[model samples]
Target: MIIELDMSSDTPIYVQLRNQIVKGIGKGEIQPGEKLPTVRQLAADAGVNTMTVNKTYQILKNEGYIRTDRRLGAFVSENINMNAEFRDKLESELELLSAEASITGMNREDFLKLCDEVYSKMKSSPIQIST
Candidate 1:
């Protein structure tokens, strides 16, 4: 949907673009089967090169977040596959985050509350456009 890329950030442009698209899907802003903007269009709108957009789309496609066809271009995938590898990686990251939170004196309840708040925000973000 609506994407705002921070050019000054240390994160690569392609990664930021990919992450925003994933967030859009998770928030239901970009529904299943919805077509995304063409790479040239998105690149122009975001003030980035087409190659960057292509890289972002490729990553999304590989991760099962989107699909592409020669004639139809790219659309949101009907199903997202969160396989065992993804689950394991998520668990490991969560463990590290939880450890950091604990070290910073974040109690179990507070940490959970924070998670809920962030999740709620992500789900509620407005879906402005299909791009």
Candidate 2:
């Protein structure tokens, strides 16, 4: 998928890259077993350093989102491990978001409807990996 990084953002580039790749997987833009660009190639494409891309890859690997190989580069993990910790984190984030929505005058139905719309849009979009 196409990843656009905001250089001025306080977040590190590697973190941004890692997050985007995760989102891509969530949206089905990056399919299981799909090969990712080599660290050098992605660095050049994103105009960042190879180390930055490598760091991102390492983080993805640790999170069970992707795997790396000496010869094959990185590939999306066919099976993501959704452990209890992951569920706890997901619930925590959702709770925070729900609270924010409630504070903003969004009813439960409206919030759920918005979530469905966004989820559908993400699922329908085609994945475009940059060379």
* Candidate-wise lDDT, in order: 0.88, 0.89
State, as a TM-score between 0 and 1, how close model 2 is to the true structure: 0.84
Clashes of each: 0, 0
Per-residue C-alpha lDDT of model 2 across residues 1-131, encoded as one tens digit per residue: 89999999999999999999999998888998999999989999999999999999999999788998998889999777677767788899999999999999999999999989877766553433322
Candidate 1 lDDT by residue in tens digits, 17-86: 9999988888889988999999999999999999999999999998778999989899998867667767
Candidates' TM-scores?
0.87, 0.84
* Model 2 lowest lDDT segment of ten: 122-131
Which candidate number would show the highest TM-score if scored against the true structure?
1
